[model samples]
Target: MDPTHADLERFCAELKAMWEACGPPVLTSVEKYGGPKKSQVSTILNGDITTVPDIDNVAAILKACLANARAKGLEPPANAEFDYWKGRLGSLTRARSNHSEPGPAGNPWRDLAGTHPVWESTTDREFFRPRVVKAAAHLFDRRRRAATVLAGDDWLDETLAQRMTDRMGDLLTGRLASPAIRFGGVEASLIVLAPLLHQVRVAESAAALIGVRPIELRPSASAGPLRSDYERFLAGSEQSRLVARTELTGVPGRTGAKNEIGWWLFHQWVMRRQDPVPTATAPHDLPIAEEPLRTVLAGTLDRLVKLFHLSPDGLRNKERRNLVHKVSHPSITPALQDVRELLVGLLLVTAHKLAVELTALPSTIVEHLGIPNPVDLGRLRALLTGMTWQPLEVIGIGLYAQCHHEAVLEALLAHVRQTDAVLGSVRDVATDRVHLEPLLRLPPRASADFVTPAPHPDNHTRPAFVVPVTRFRIDETRVRELLMGEQLYSDRSLAIRELYQNALDACRYKQARHRYRAALEDT
Candidate 1:
């Protein structure tokens, strides 16, 4: 189907050569058979003018193919002439054998099937009388003709022996088996079952072995072949399923609370000074959040801003925008809440990858940050434009949503405890970073927004808590050196995670560092 008409023309040309190589027979009486003379045989050959192919030549080709095919257990030609022709070529000839077997008396199959008149019945017609008859006849005709041309006067005796030997060989090779056949619907019959014609019969034994009762296997609808992957896809192995579940839920003791570590890391980073330790309230009149929370929140905000490539709130108009601005007007708040979620997840995942890399078996750092679900990545996306949020891949929408919810839970919990202002366990969230916004979305509570000291520009992206993995005295040069080597630090996740882990160690082991609960204790 993919081929064009040109391909068909080329195939027809090849057919012409094959016909010439084969000595095909035509009905002949040396005079009665009428058609073009030898001089006008162009109809049977390729030339400028196209003509119908010679019927006899096509028949011979088909017969030869069928004979070969029948020997190989493939389908064969349908016409009776071809089947007899196959038997003739396959078996040796003898005077005692059928005359038409291989001598151009046409084919036996056609005569037996009444395809030819009774008087015109060929030696080929009588040859198929016995399954072995054609084999003997074909051998005689060929060997006798060959011996006359090769061994001279001794042709008769010598040819008989040679022809018999050749026929026996056909027996062993199965070329002496069933006659040629062709495409037809349920068309086999015992009368048609005879030696194939025109094909070379190699070993005589093959003829003896064929045409035996065939085996037919009962078809089973369900017993078909299957793909190799079938079993794996269907079978729910305990180990693989377990892995899938762990990855989906992010195992509680695994990836959840790494965010809490951020809260801790932030505090330590803002102030590397360990002695006469800097306090959150130590900065004179500044009423920052409790010691560690203030510094941690501030540092975390700085990191978030950096992670998103957001311009600091104060820095502006550095990059070109869609419209010209007078340094006077600013677009709406760049969304920061949505951006925070992605950064937080990256931090958590980074921590997990680190733990596996370092072979560090830290328990439950992420689990502590198990935020609620319905991870509203979609809702959060809208919020970003409303708040002038920073850059964050949308993929982390679900993650940020969960983190945002976690923060809300922490905030609600903190509010109730600090002011003895008990509210029902939060049912639904209206906005991120819980404000005095009433539970009802309708009339914004007059006190809903941060009415007290407003959040600082630097504090916009900062979440309530984050933890760093570790902290130690190191020159800025040393920190950079480790980064360059990817040894002591990696990215935010590694640096922040290590800092947090260190702070936790410092908090628990007083002997490890100066005791500083101000940085960690929930303010």
Candidate 2:
């Protein structure tokens, strides 16, 4: 109705904290500073007023507090604090007016059907229950419409009809009125009704496509539940009388028991009818029909390059393989196999690009880039020789000829050997030298050698070696400075209000849980 007594008390406590934190200046000093007297401030802070304080008085007190904060070198209160209080005051004023007026007839609390069992508090129940009830009612109405269509064919047997009647009666009279039927239960029951409605709709669509004669097939004495009827329709095992009564004249396949009647009819009418092909130039660039397939392929390639550091071997690791499977769509079983081949192809392409770039480098640059140490040169050659194009054959088999594969493999090997020879020659030269140290050092002609840079005066000023240090602790002096500072008052009150509201909400939640638990114990 209005701001509750507890809410007002909480607001007063927050106001007092803000005032005290601002130095709680003497009442005479506040009066001298063009603000209300100390007694008025105390009355406001102590929640002594019969009504909420005037906005002007509140503003004056805040201004005085700001003055006190500035005088003490503390941060002044923020404008946001004033704005928050202004909004609260408005709400309280409106609520007070509403409290004096008569309420509507129905009890909002009793009318609420706690349909969602997951509701953590009474407030959530009150807020969400009505919305859930409306949605369920909408679904129920749609289900009945579908039922009416099915009833024309005499599909509604006596037992099935009675079951639907009872369920609808329970929904309208009992569950809708009772507070016990939670959102979860209502949702679950709706799911149970969905399949029956879906089957009926599918049957109607299939019958229309096949151009079957309309027969008023009612439920016979031998009819079972709606679930059974739906199962029969889906399985294509329903009686021959329910199947397409007309000859499937143009349709090719002979009717069989194994095939579902609706699916057969749909396949004949829809699947067999092809639309004209588009004349657009880039037909091959059409979007993938399966979104998950594209997503998995893109993600796999990205992760293979970035996360796995472009290492083809990393793709074969158990962890990476498992991740691929985990993200793959369950419907696409060959997704993993396709990913493996594509990853191998991508790796080969990357290797080919690298080889081409390396071979393009001038012989002078390549010689200068050679490994200086014999041990390093030996390792380089071993690594290069180990690079084989055997895996590319898996991708190139039908995609490319054997001769082309061999030619590409030979080119890759030639590049590796040429690079290895450059390193080997450098290693030999370094070994033959009387002093290898000079070869390892930067040449005297280098720019770095010509320009001598001065060292930084402070070790801490050097970016390479400098490390940052931070210490955290509560300081009253700093806090006071902050309170008196200009930025202090801005967002402080809004934050405190939110925190206070959350605390009150948490209390209500615990109370609701306690009540729920007690109810469970009683039952």
Candidate 3:
């Protein structure tokens, strides 16, 4: 075995031992600077070595492990222990020259590759998380829009729309618990999206979903010559919006008329008997209202269909496309690179849709609430939404890294965060919205980090309140009798005498203290 690879493996093994002894902390809890992402840290703990580990990342993991140990009441590792690990890392770093660069290999769908460089904290979120979220959001939005328009005059299917909204929230926030949505892989995207795609029924509301009417695209001699096909297609009143959407999709074939867009939308990329399959299942019988519009739409539809790699007869070939259906159904022996390509393409399309569409609008709760500060309202919405999606997005980032590296599945379980814990945070924020409103508006720490409420203090039994003994007693009856002045003089006289004695005692006590202080000064 290569010396560097061997040393790297040994380092990983020892690191794992340390983790088990300290704790495989919830990876996110490890506080370190300039460290590898939690997912990479997780891989290290699992002894899945591909590249030379960063020393700072290694030190951070060790530090976190030690911190966890200290929290658990274990004795702190001595300086010598730290020095030993540091020495190991130093040796591994020096031997790094002998190690060959890593590349992709493994199960096409799940295994994380070794070649994918470790993600930094910020870059992880920037690359792939937003794309998955935005895709799901846009796709969910399009479905809702289609439902309202196509359900016709009698359409009152609020239930379907609500379910879709909830499902979208659940998926985005990582509350939904299914393997299909867990990994943020192409399979996961396809699985989460497949049902909604079927529900859209593109033929019935093609015009509405496409967002532009067929008649609106009528050829005009008044329109000036264009330098590019894109300019020609977008020439008109809605040209600005169309140009923006095109950039958003990143798919050149996306800009087209209702029928043309609808054709692509209708085809569902699905898992059939555990194999990837693309079927023209959604009906495409939308009628062309005008003959001239119909002729124009047909040609446009043909061109887009051809551009997207579908046969004229609606048959799909085993070629790379927007959806990952290249593998023959039930066959698992395909090249890893091909699988990676399919996933990348699918994700890119979804992410592009997310970027173009209005994905970051406030949730309905945020919109309806009577929050005064725009900043507070916006931040609260982000907190609620980010809590839901961040966990899943992290996993998506890992998958994106893996595919990008062209590597196979490593330890995917390592990437999973406490999603339930995350959703619980969302619930906490929503339930405490009334209480949180004031905090949300406060300045100079307005968006201070929120802590989840601890269990009620009342849950455990404690000592009861202690009542103090009476320092004095009120003689209400005597006072009333005295006030009347009709009582015998002897009884009134006794009460008055007692009050006088108490007053004299207090004055004398003060006089004595004063005299004593004077006497001490004289001495």
Q: Whose TM-score is greatest here?
A: 2
Worst 10 contiguous positions by lDDT, candidate 3? 402-411
TM per candidate comes to: 0.13, 0.21, 0.19
Question: Would you list the rank order by TM-score, best first?
Answer: 2, 3, 1
Candidate 2 RMSD to the real structure: 36.8
- Sequence-dependent TM-score of model 3: 0.19
lDDT of each: 0.27, 0.36, 0.35
**RMSD to native for every prediction?**
44.2, 36.8, 27.8
Which prediction has the highest lDDT against the true structure?
2
Q: What does candidate 3's lDDT look like per residue over 45-72, in tens digits?
A: 7768777777777777777877788789
lDDT of 3: 0.35
- Cand. 2 TM to true fold: 0.21
> Considering lDDT, which of the candidate structures 2 and 3 is the better prediction for this target?
2
